[model samples]
Target: MHTGLHFISGLPRSGSALLAALLRQNPDVHAGITSPIGSLISMLLREMSQGNESAIFIDDTQRKAILRGVFDGYYGAISQTQTVFDTNRLWCAKLNVVAALFPNAKVVCCVRHLPWVLDSIERLTQQNRWELSKIFNFDPGGTVYSRVEGLVSSSGLVGFAYNALKQAMHSEESDRLLLVSYETLTREPQRALDAIYDFTGLPPFQHDFESVTLDANEFDARLGTPGLHKVGNAVRPNERQSILPPDLWRRFEVDSFWSEPAWNLRGVRIV
Candidate 1:
């Protein structure tokens, strides 16, 4: 069955996985950890572009239809009553494509402080000391400085998403975007969820903050970074000292553009 489609995207180590777990509490909502649908869409676009010799054979109408079918076919098995919220970090960069395909769909971006985001990833890396992380291409060895540098490189995981999110905030379709802060979500989940419900035009449902749970153990295991997506059985802030050195922390502090109101030129909603 087919129904409205929304998206969950934002920085890594943010509350996206937690948000998906909570959103799933509402029977009408269907969401999960990041899916390959975004990558699939990207691949399809590249294949249809001039990079492929067969591109000349496909018209814009056909291209649009094919892209739309990706969503339909991906969630085609879900019940018609459910509103699908696909999770992917690439959606922020593809807002124009999404706007054309599903004008009403809103993108909920979960964000966190840049330093803490890096700290979270570092924590996971340290915990899995026995295994090399797929994040760094399993490169065997490097100091925290090198790792932090790699992460903030333009094409790196955090860097690309950060840039894409900034792009979305200033986009003409900014009204269709919502930023969910990790602090706000952990300290005031109900408030964040209320804003999300209003933005997506979905009826509110009570979520058990004390019983939230999501197990992506296998997924993280495959990535060689266990607990990467594990948010525990409860939705609460886990306060701790930043493992990041003060120098490194300060270096990336300025990268958190979402913290500044002036950067939000299009008035993208933040919760």
Candidate 2:
């Protein structure tokens, strides 16, 4: 019995893996660490575009059907009654294709403060001081200004996802989107889980918050990050000081754009 598909997306280092880990506790849901389906979405879109597969007799309707099959075929391995959630930072950018292919699908964006997100990355870099991370392409030459510019620039990682999220929040499918904040997700997990269960319409499972843990070393290593997705074995308040210089951190803390009054007007719910 096939159920439906939703997405776990938004900024990296913002609890996407933690959400997937907790959701997996529900036997009825098939959620996991970031999946490659988003990349596949882009790949298929290019393959099916006008100058490509369209010239080979494949039409738009057939293309849409085939694209839908990709989800079915990929997650078809999960058992009956299980909901599918493919995690990726790229899904926020692919929401249009998602709304078209799986009209009922929702994208649950994992969000955190931009300054803290950058601080988290910096902490990891310092902890692994002996080695350079692929996150910065192993280049450690830049000053704080340049490094930040790389992240907030239009083509940068966070910039791109933030733009994509803003687009989805204003879209006609805004009702299908949910923003899950990291602070609430880790602090008051029961409330967070309840909200997630209601949003995705999945049967609730008794999650063991005290013993929650996920190991992503093998996968993280592939991306040149060892503990990028690591979380405490328990869901509890995580308090830590920023290792970044005060001035550097202040530059990115200027705004909490996602929670501003303007988005409320668009009817996108933030919890």
Candidate 3:
């Protein structure tokens, strides 16, 4: 009774959680809320790095249990006909590292405009107990947020993330994947959900579209002033404005080393 694995990945705040939450409403789908295996795997990597001698082994039953645990924790309890979904930001990267482990895994990569993505990240840093370095695993004293801000403002981070995404898309197992954009999903949610349903082989659910709209004030609160300041004007920019500040956008355009045809190849226009 092994349901196939489905992954929803994207840049931070690109609606991965929203998508997962929406998909969970479907009776035939069970999304993992907490993935113990992923957590364990992360801990195992940390242990190994610290020279700990703990051996992590996976057998068939254990694998099934881990998958089931992931399903129940994130999406809810699994049913007989349910397709399990694991929605996490870094899951795609982990999926790439262990592609062979799950033969029938399906990956969905979510994308958002670079400017908006950077803006969202910046906003989060300014509000609450924002710690960019801790989240990104950088030194506590390092200027990680500032550096990231520079990269995003200059559009360099977009290309880097896009390239990484492209590499994931081009894997030999690429057919079992789908690439989606946040703008499309936000604007035409029904259409986007329909596409996601088709891709994941799940039936559609009764979704609350109105409840999902992005809240400007709330978003700003989470992001803070400095983060909001950098990409504030770029939110849902018009075509002309999409050409962000020239110097920064040009970096990714000209860098051959960072470019990947499969990943960077533009699909449908999002905005």
Candidate number achieving the greatest TM-score relative to the actual structure: 1
- Residues 95-119 of candidate 2: C-alpha lDDT, one tens digit per residue: 7788888777888999998888877
The C-alpha TM-scores of every prediction are 0.98, 0.93, 0.62
- Cα-based lDDT at residue 82, candidate 1: 88
Poorest lDDT segment (10 consecutive residues) of candidate 2: 47-56
Candidate 3: residue 29 lDDT (0-100)? 72
Global Cα lDDT for candidate 3: 0.52
| Model 3 C-alpha lDDT per residue in residues 192-233, reported as the tens digit of each score | 778877776666666775443222344433434222212221
- For candidate 1, the lDDT comes to 0.91
lDDT of 2 at 58: 81
Q: How accurate locally, in lDDT, is each candidate?
A: 0.91, 0.80, 0.52
Pairs with steric clashes in candidate 1: none
Better candidate by lDDT, 2 or 3? 2
